[model samples]
Target chain A: MVDRPGGNPRAAVVGTGLIGGSVLLRLHRRGLDVTGWDPDTATRAEGRARGIPFPDELADAVRDRDVVFLCGPLSSLPETLLTVAKHTGPDCVLTDVGSTKGGIAGFAAAHGLSDRFVPGHPMAGAERAGLTAAVPDLFDGAAWVLCPAATGIERFRTLAALVIDVFGARVVPMAPDAHDAAAALASHIPHLLAGSLAGAVADADLRDAVLGLAAGSFRDGTRVAGTPAVRTADMLLNNRDQVLAQLGRVTGLLDRLAAALRAGDAVALVGHYQRARELRLALLDRELPPVVRDFPLGGDSDDELAYLLSLGAAGGHLTGCRVAAGTVTYTGHLSTAPA
Target chain B: MVDRPGGNPRAAVVGTGLIGGSVLLRLHRRGLDVTGWDPDTATRAEGRARGIPFPDELADAVRDRDVVFLCGPLSSLPETLLTVAKHTGPDCVLTDVGSTKGGIAGFAAAHGLSDRFVPGHPMAGAERAGLTAAVPDLFDGAAWVLCPAATGIERFRTLAALVIDVFGARVVPMAPDAHDAAAALASHIPHLLAGSLAGAVADADLRDAVLGLAAGSFRDGTRVAGTPAVRTADMLLNNRDQVLAQLGRVTGLLDRLAAALRAGDAVALVGHYQRARELRLALLDRELPPVVRDFPLGGDSDDELAYLLSLGAAGGHLTGCRVAAGTVTYTGHLSTAPA
Candidate 1:
């Protein structure tokens, strides 16, 4: 293990399954002071077996920690985040690795912990579950989204620097609601479509006949449908509000295309397809924009938080941070003309 | 060129685009007498430049041919097939490489040419268009569906034999309607879903923000959305009847899942996803059944045609054919138990 420069935040992870275990591994490798605690005894034992400290009581683990990462399952996250938040030492910051942010973020706001709490989602995973699948490099070069609030700006900066410098991830700051909306657009809705496609093919008259006709389109479209039904169900239900809205938009498009095909209106059909083709091309040919900008840290103002949030909403990504020197650097994301 | 033995049907390809040119190359490589023709002068020139015999007139090119493949665009297939059928030598068989079978099959039934016209769709192609992308092995290991009518049984066997022996393709014999229905389920509807996925993501409020969240599911689901709008529109429109019916089924599934999510009906959601997952596993784990059955050729009876159609409907595949010795050998396709 290699020791890092000054001001390495002492960290505590409340869950030691995939994401949390991965955080523990990465932190330990950096020679930083990190502790892990899992509510499940078996999981806690597994973390201890890996030569990391795992205190029996969550309170004991989180005491004197500078930041506590709530990496529990979504079903258990509400209680878990609040419990950890309530127990953390004064001035300690809190963040999470949950998929949907609204639930836990709301709990934070309702309990008046917004100033010391930030919610995050790291876009990385292995196909397998639990600490067995965890690795130190899991977050390297991955996108770690942090929804920063004005009240939480200082802690947000501290947490953001830890994510970028220690975990080797780029942070994308979004408001909790916007993050859920974008997740719906990019991940959740496509999965629903995949399930629908797979189900339709399976329910066809003869499975063999359809399988014989299956090609790249069928394979690619249905690929995600095989994701664990439990996880998939949770993902959709957890963010149903945004998913429902996006689902409506997608079904509207499907209805229009179906109508055009039924009408045998070739002009309408081609024009409708043209729009999708143009967008696909624009996305494929887009290069990452290269304008890097810096925001002064420790400002502790609403403007600073809003600026960071706006940059992420505009798709800018945090490239690096110097917590000791107090600056966060980011670059604008896409360089494509809108379709 | 290696000469193929007995009854090598003298072949003429009437539209030297990718599929037609590929057929020409495959035939010529097998030392079959082949002539290529295209209405476009440049395409014809490209064909001749590739050392194919591109006779100036379509009638002259197809004269004395034992079989004529109408390989034109979907819009012109009807006229081109009829025109070639009008000029070909007596007893000449006709087939096509069009994606849709209904329009041309209906025209053949109307024109009293069903006895010799066998509509086919070869499941193969290059990404690029025209003779430039043509290759002798384009049909290698591909499924060539011959929608055999009882009246066209003899000609169907001959074409099936040619497809198997010369082009190295497996002939799947189907009734025209079944072929269209299978195509709709496997190809057409999946394409529409892909386009809808792509268009929805493109039309999201912030493209870069959405794109950032786009991962394997979005990419795979939208992979075929980039298929040229003209071709995709034509495919959906040509098979609109089956495509529309399948669309309703898919949208129905989507709506059910959406409602379940809306009502927090986890049971319905998980059960729905379970069905698709089971089907996917069945397909992936299925081993090809190895019972080869022999059908005596030259029967020319309705019994022979019905047997072939039933095999295809059950998804059995033609493994080999002996045109002169008079038999077709096929093996059952999927050993997968019903999902």
Candidate 2:
């Protein structure tokens, strides 16, 4: 790791899983001294094993630390931030790595610590989390959105620049309300949509079949559904208003498209695809530096039905194997028996 | 190799890439004498290089083959099927692994090949394609959807059973319309959305920035957009009606949610997410057997943007060194990247 430049203040990151671990790695690579905290002992141990120092107490982690980064679940942010606020140094800054900002900002204000808090989100993560999952190059060239909570302009700019310097991420300053709304459209709603889709096909047998047939389309569409349940519930419950608003827009889009199809209006239908295409492209153009994903591949797996989860094995021939009487024998290694 | 029980029907797979190559793998594994063909000489040569013999012509491939599989671009399917229909043996059964069925089925009937054609879709494939990219285990437990013409019940069923035995996939039969509509929703529309998103961010600079901060949410939201341009255009152009219909539905959903946000209708917004969650869950529960995925890392990648552009990067993840600094360094023993 590069040595931090003179006057570069240290930052404390709480909950060193995917998000926190990534923040820690990015901060460290950019030469910022980072101290991490995770309630999960194993997760903390893993972080320690990876050579990232872990603080046992919230106060110990944040005290005198130039900035405190709350990189935990959305639901946990309010209480944890509140707890941090109680013991924080008045001059020290505080921020969060939560996806939804409005609710957390509100929580900060309710606890009378709004001036010290600046909510931010780095729009990046992978399918894995934890300290061992940490990589120093996590946030290079990503968009780190900051939603200041009535914090002074100097403080916000300082925090934002610090993020840019430490994570190599661009700073996009947004109001907490706007941040929540934007995230509802871009992130929260998508998660809820995926969860809903997963919930809809709750049938074990159907899930087994679906998982096999689930190509990129299904996988992409339902990826967010794999986020831990606690995070899902936190975002759903905390940013209820913004998420609901975004959901309404999505449903509206679905209805319009469905109506066009029902009406047999091919022109109208194509227009919708074109519009969606444009919107999606616009969203994608806003690149984010890669980071370890906060969410794990969620849901209970059926070990018995695991045999049924075939991937891309159709309409193609299998090499080194032949089938006879409905069983396959292969020349190369076989991972598992067919369901 | 498993012995082909008494006269295991000979089969032919045309267009040996992704779907076609995979079809060959499964069939060969099942002990069928599988012949392969592709218009691209290099692809055919790669198959040959890999010990997968490629027939010089379609007729040469399927002359005595009991089952003929057409696995090519959607636009090419009609013409290819027409050519095959003229020379295919009267007893030979013909099936296609196209994304859309309505157009192909319509084209077959127009070409006087209706009775011989059974439209099918193997719900699988990577953003990557080609014979060299083929895997023997591509369709082990995915869904192989078949849309049989009215008079070809027995032939379709036999083909379906063969698919099951070969790929270890579930044979799901549905009316062509249902299959087409569902494909439009699950596959076609998603592709269009991804492309649209990619298109919006076509600006190289923005793409670079957005990609760095990009997390799984954006990647999943835009995964299908990485589909090849020709194939993407063909899918949209051929299934224009269904794709357009679905686009309208999605746009409507977007609009409604936008309006709800404007109106601050928290209740409506939450309801929408709840409903979408249900739909996603329902999708997850459905069992589709015989599909296979070749990616061992499950789609996370360090150079995903480059990979999506068809750069061969070992499927996912960077094993050693940083691409950020413009050099490919091997820190440890590295396997050659996937072709």
Candidate 3:
């Protein structure tokens, strides 16, 4: 209906999980002749039951497909790609939807399909997994990172773009190693660290008490930890080097933060806060070089007041009040500002 | 109609903001004769206009009140307490709802009124702050932590239990220093870290991108940072020592984690994941300990299955299509062996 851009292109999507299925939906909606395959027949049957066309045989599914999307566990992608290459059309463009790249790219090169494969990762997912959880809008506004295969195929690159665009995602071109590194810091290592933090406190009673008091902080810090173990395990096993490298950098940062705390340098602590605040604000507004805007509180209350007042003291004015049991709180907006 | 437990005990609530208002509402609903006072007349007027009784004067508010609740910035607690002591009934049990405890406990000891003040913190709030934002169930299903003041009266502790019970919150008794340390680790330092992390990413594009990419992780990490500066500043300034101490511990843990990552020990990385898994799981069921259960992924995944087996293998599930781009997800359960 949407012009079916990749129409009549024989497409093979291996793995009918959330990402893979969603990609299939996008490609199918774009009018590409699509076929779904998975090692698990029951899962295939489940997909077929949902009215999605799933061919019985893997070879039949990929025989004429012009493009193949290797979307599954990172650990399985290597073998799956080899399997697909053996059966897919000679001119087929192969790509993957794994989060990391360097290793996968190496694997593709070793498999002699470097020219036909493009490594990509769509930075989109919910805590929930599986094809049943797939939604059309999942990738809409999500970033689809493409890492060109070492032996480049311009047509394959173009195909990669179509794959990304078809899914309503923006294509971000990056080198395989670079992409892996970026993901290590931005996603993989963060996930591991979140899981580790959650693991740090393992006592049952203490854990419950801590969780009971757990508000947003715990939630944010450990969000990626909720990913299914199978997926996480694949990422960890496949992208070990880059993840470790990024962990090194983060550890250095953590060390400095710790030293600052131990030193009782209020100024340094505030500096950290300022840095974090500036980065957050810039990210919120998409400011390039990262800037911090300074505004002053009208009265000489304190630096905190100054910052609050400077942040455009709007209808949400600061009112100082003490609640039940003498817990003091600053509440409300100013009369000059609209509520 | 509920036995108005607050009637004869003229209640003086310092810092008449959100928490204070909620406490007042519960007290009022319980038939307590409550009076509120704030440095800002408008806040007091707003409370009064909203049907919360406001005292003619601070001294008059606590003169005959049997219980007094100090609700304000942790930094201002000492000064407020000193002032309250000057006008408080000798028999009055003074308590507060500050997040930190050691300082408040010290304040009472230093001010020669150790027997009357009970320190408490309600683990509940919202991004919106004001008298108008106050709601009755603010403390529902929340934790009401009590740090018994050195000079606290037994009746004061009983009164606190009576008051917090109305909100459906389970009262947890803890020591002043312990409570301060716990809050520092669980809440204060996390906020500081989140703010600092957000501020560190100075790239405007990256900032927004980060925010956009922020699924559950960044939101949970920076959740507390989204609150008002007044509360943040107060927590930092008041609980400086304890917060710093906890930060030291967190830094140490993070250092070890970083080292594990840098060493590129897959085993160590896996160990971290395993530990995190145990900790996270421990936090879910209420029957577990409070320490390790600091954060819980409250969402239930009933229909989800981890597609881990090979094609045609037992329990194997497929996700995407082979011929067309479609998904088939497995709806089964993971083997319930503890990770």
Candidate 4:
């Protein structure tokens, strides 16, 4: 793998789902020789239809590939890694995009494949899933965590960095346990909270009223609850200890707020909220670059011009100007900085 | 008050904050004879600067108004409503925009003012607060809940409906107790959850790491945590019983999920998440109409025209046409519908 320093390396991705297919597409777009293998016929056909090269046999896809990516669901990662280990060439660098890193690292260590494996998790996903949900920019600007095992080879890092660069992701390295713990607090717990909040409404007799009255706060707070259940369960079980610990911390906070409410101790309740508000503000201060998207204008009438101006001023950073071919384009930042 | 059927009514808004100033601005936009009063000197100054008529004495603002809106914080609403009852004429309609309706209704009933009061909770807010944060379109397309007291007069309903219509809000009527309960699950509990999630990060030694990796899910999930602490505390304490009840339900769901994780029972965990996901999707499926806004273009250059087209094509329903003053304006819907 080290011999291909300035050249596009051969890559194979197992499981052509959202994460995997996205990696394949992004790598392909970046001019890599990529191949894919998935168990499902429909997924494989879909990948092929999207111009992704699919090898009929798993071993054929894995063999001689400089890098092998196990981008399957958490439940299937261990088996997929084993298949990669058995089929990949001696110099191949193994990586994965599973939500949890600890379990995958442990499996690789136990199988004596630790040196060749780099357990990575992309902190980016959509509520949608599968091949159709795959996008080339899915991992752009996302944090891509690489928890390299103690015995992992440097080549694995190099290969992983190259793939991450293709996806335009920022690489973050941490110990496997630390990665799991941080993820539990930042991602897993939020999902649990979203689901639990939604569940509370589901169990309420006034479900219709509650849903109707739900505003931006409720909608945003429960957005993750719409994610696929099996995927969430897989991540939760894979990172059980850390998820449980974070859940305990959150529950304790909830209890304190509840107590303050019961005692009519507005000062104490305000203190808790103030601290949380400060923390949220601090988190928001970490800024990212603006998101810009382009559009084409079709008409040149007064109504068309009014419509364009309306679109530009529609509660965001949209601005526009005319271009060639009677086209008008606009650039705007999509994300709103916290107030 | 009933003498003005289609005519603009005389209205007064107490507490010149975001909600209050917005009401004043929108009502003024609708050609109402509006006046405002606030205990805070700075807020009152800001409102006056925005062209809102203000009286130095609270009673003076309330005296001749056909409707008096107590738009203060939850803690201040009782006193404000008492002031309105003391000065307003017999036919005047009374209302308040407190998050929790039951407390306000109880206070009104105790003061023999229940018949004139229609407690409301607007399902709209911003992270920003105060007079500068007020916008004429703040309540547009938002749900304006009217938890009218049992003894509330018909005039109150009529006046509230007119105000709601002016704000372009959809009016939803419910019993005070029912409104409180529903709001606990839909709004208050969600805020508590957001705060708790942020609080968990605050307590962690890896706070920076967690925050850095916090993606769309965490950001959206914790957005309400950025809201002012005193306001949240007031709302929580005002609806203590319902808030506690909803918290209890959320905790129960969390406990079940934790138990399933501990047992490594994927089936049980999946069931909990599946039910939640279904509930969330159902809630989201209750669609609302799109929100449209307009922007005015400055120049007629090809580059400017291109910009307009690009703006129109950016991930929304954007369209534009030429208008007076060489303006090429565009119209775009602001919010995305559920996928």
Candidate 5:
């Protein structure tokens, strides 16, 4: 499968926004035959002006491409996936760069495209937006999640290897629902907290006073609150159940904290913060466990898939894959980085 | 009291922690006759090695100083204040560098020291701790909040001017209770959120998997979780009323957000995030309101004090002050930075 050089993907990105543009740029730089497309004319022209390879038609852009990325907005993803699927080769591996995985996973299952669909969510973002702000290194050292399906194992492995070798991203194999849940904590919660924290200060009796007093904490905490409203809303809405679940857990913690503070319960307050501090210290510790090589990519058994997903759950990441040898590599703690 | 040099007040820092050390360094660099004192023998030795002025006794360190800063831990502030006060000159302006203001403010009031006690909370911090990590620019462009008292007007102006002219800090004149509320939202909440979020992942089903997926949001949001548990607890307890109150407001916001996610309410979710986005944008915008000069520091009236607190509430900051001219200046919005 390492057929035409720079390793295995003849790819096409269907959206020219930040995520898609970034993927396109990274792949193109890696000497991959990567084509770009966007139905929006202005974006297409901008891509052209920026020297990104843009073929005239969507079908032509995707034709014969082994990897076809459907990078449309959440509202348009289902249709865009179906449309792009019509243009791609039968052996093509389909994927997306969305934050949420369940919606696309469901759409693929319903349409019987799970065999070809390898659901993905790149765990990366920047403060800026659009094609102009996209950079090739956006995915460098970032987690590019691949939610495996029952039959997409071969293509999934192929793409995961290329994602690792080409872009230097860590391939985290997860189940669709699992991806949603973890994302709710790692990615979505920041948006929720950002919105909530920023909202509280907006209603502050002294707005400038609060803002003036806002230092690195407030700035870093609310960084995501600046994300475009429509995009943030769609992400939260699509992963509603998981987001709601995680939000419930976090709010419970915050409630107990408030109670502790209200009662001036020294032990309770200290215990609450100390738990987090210790966990954080563990998470942040530099001395991680040894690398475990050759976590199998051979069989598509439920046991194998579960093991792979469990590795991700345990904070293990695929540093690289010995694809031809039918295995991947990981560097992880037995439990967490600190542990 | 520009008697010994730089700009004003022969200043002295009573404790040589991060805050005190930074103040000492900044003032010392500005050519002031500043001395440092630390009860801890090792810390005093460290200060000496670092070329920070460390007179042998606490009384000598503060002797005849026009301004004295009590920079001990929250637990030591009261006694430290009394001890330091005994050694200072009659006209000395006593202040502190604590995050929460109400405790010491109450102490000043109860002890009849309100006339000299100018409660201050410098809105600055560093990732590292102690004299080893101290830097002079820590408070540059940061808010040095001085919670106004009925009788501390003259000394308050004297110290506020030195805070501005010497260290380039903006003196935010707030009431003690108000300072606590703002600090709760700005400082304490970050610690709460960090610990809660970190705790959630530590107990994840596949700890490593959740840990693997954690990114910039997780890092920044949980940044404060790394703060020492004892200190975090003390700060929270010291500002219990305000921290609990702000925590209630924030948790209420989070609960509503979870409800929006649970209901899959598009408008509600979008509206929630959009409100934050709008406020964040407003807070982040570079174009600010006109400066209001001569906000009287001469008057200690109820109305003048209220007006000062209101200025902070509206997101207004003092760019500079004209101390001898009996006025401070401001750069603020009518309501919020966005407003």
Candidate 6:
């Protein structure tokens, strides 16, 4: 196992919601010394019930942590970061799991915390939210974009590497503005389209027949329409300009399709469909970096050996090993990282 | 089992592609005397290899059949129906599994075959097409709309009932025009939206990152984008007006969302999402009619009895029973239709 660069670094996660709770759980499972805090008493209690060390006071949670993660609702992230900055150690790095990076980056700059902050967004989520929905493997194999502050490249890179090493997430670094623009096109606009599509069938008269005959294509196409309104609104409003730009482009495409249908232009319709099919197939074949991690083997018993063999069978390559006392520490690479 | 109303009805299915091959295979499994014909030699050969009876000539295939099903591409359906009308027996009922009904219905009417033609559309499909992609249970639990000819409702009903009884499909009858409009909203426009959404991401600069970070929402939202262009184009062009209308509605909804995002109107955005979520959840909870089928018991041995018991445990109700020598004739209702 690669020893953590600065010994056993202490970490604290604020919010204890889905993203925050998941980060805390995954870090704790990887043997990191971590604590959590949430403004909501019930949420903090739930996190503690899940075996996460939770401090009732936010200040206590952040006092001496080497890294502090602010993961809360997008609207409240700036305020939460301000509070975290006050209590965290001077040398501690700060980061977030917010959906949009531009606003958070701006807030860090306004507060003169830019050098200590790295804005991040894990491109993964479930329809459900909150502490109960957190899972250790939530970020596994997912794209976790890290927009490091220009002034603190080294500090940001170190913290990013530590997080990626523990979560087994593929980290892609991009400028905050570029990341917001790309996310608008890739995520936000698609979500809005799903909601609009669902809204099209909301008419009382058409609801029954449309719902009754709806099959896989409709259901799959509109799955994101079920995302809660508050979350969707926060995303769209936060990334307003980029989301609006994407919506314009999509609107243009939809218009062309409508014109083709109106004119009964089969060739034009076929051209659009062919282009889309080719692009979608290309996406399905796109490859990403493999996930590799250091698994701390607890013992050399039969069950432990069998478990190690099973991991190898699952396309994990054993890279290095260390034998200390009765424990065997094995570092390996994993294929097909969990979602 | 429900005795064939017309006594051992013979059937001929044209095209022998995915839908046609599936229909042929399923009817053959139900002990119907069926034959198939396809213009494409390889497709016909594949169907034949799967043990479906195939006649070398279209005329021979339709000569003595009680019914003929045209299951070719939507663009070629009109011509195929015209040819079938010329070759089929005088009393034979004609039907089709085309996605768009208006054009085929008009063609049948113009050819003076309205008395024998039933326009049908089975709302089930896979991204893959042709005989190689055919599955016998493709129609089970799917909505199969039948638009009967104005002149021969009784004949059309009989044929639709037979198709549903054997395939265990939910058969909903509607006027040809109404069916076209409903399908535009429920299926055609959704496919177009998927393609358009995919088209939005086809820009060269955005392709790599968009593809890399796309999660479940984007993947599911654009799944139908991978459907073959020719088929999608055919459906859009054939039902031009209705598809155009639905596209207009969807475009308006998208425009409202774009305006809300541009204005930073969180409340408006939330309203749209809440409406969509409510509609989607309601759709998930909507109930449909139970699948009832007559499953024929094949034998009276221990294994056969075990199989019968298993069927019963799966929600099939014993409807009738008869015994002659060692063979047993038992009919039961199947609870869950296979698809």
**Model 3 lDDT on a 0 to 1 scale:** 0.59
Error of 5 at B130 (Å): 2.2
Candidate 6 stretches with Cα past 4 Å from truth are A1-9, A28-32, A287-339, B1-9, B28-32, B148-151, B156-163, B288-339
DockQ for every prediction shown = 0.50, 0.09, 0.14, 0.28, 0.66, 0.32
> What is residue A246's positional error in candidate 5, in angstroms?
2.6
Better of 5 and 6 by TM-score: 5
Q: Tell me the deviation in Å of residue B127 in model 2.
A: 1.9
Per-residue lDDT of model 1, residues A1-339, tens digit only: 012345677889988888889999999999989999988898889889978889999999998888888887777887887788778755888888987889778988998888888999987654346787789999987778998887757677777778888898878889999889888877788889888878877787856676665666777777778766777788788898999988877888888888888789999988878888877776566566666666676554666667677767766677655443556665435344543
Better of 2 and 4 by TM-score: 4
Interface RMSD of 6: 7.3
Could you give the CAPRI-style class of model 2?
incorrect
Q: Model 3: how many Å of interface RMSD?
A: 10.1
Cα lDDT of model 3 by residue, A80-125, tens digit = 8888889975578788999878888888788777777888787777
Question: Cα deviation in Å at residue A268, candidate 5?
Answer: 1.2
TM-score of 3: 0.71
Which digits, one per residue and each the tens of the lDDT, describe model 5 over residues A1-96?
444555556889998788888888888887778889998888888887867668778888888888887777777888988988988766888999
Number of the top-ranking candidate, with DockQ as the measure: 5
The clash count of every prediction, one per candidate, is: 0, 115, 86, 55, 14, 0
User: What TM-score would every model get versus the actual structure?
Assistant: 0.83, 0.60, 0.71, 0.81, 0.92, 0.81
Candidate 2 i-RMS: 12.4
- Isolated chain A: TM-score per model? 0.87, 0.76, 0.78, 0.82, 0.92, 0.82
- Candidate 6: tens digits of C-alpha lDDT, residues B103-175: 8888888998888898888888877788888888998878777764437654554565666677877655556
Candidate 2 local lDDT, B226-275, one digit each (tens)? 55455655665667676665555555554564465556565765566555
Leading candidate by lDDT:
1
Which has the higher DockQ value, candidate number 2 or candidate number 5?
5
Q: Write the per-residue lDDT of candidate 6 for residues A15-106, one digit (tens) a residue.
A: 87778888989988998889999999998888788787788999999998888888888999998888888987567888898889898898
CAPRI accuracy category, model 4? acceptable
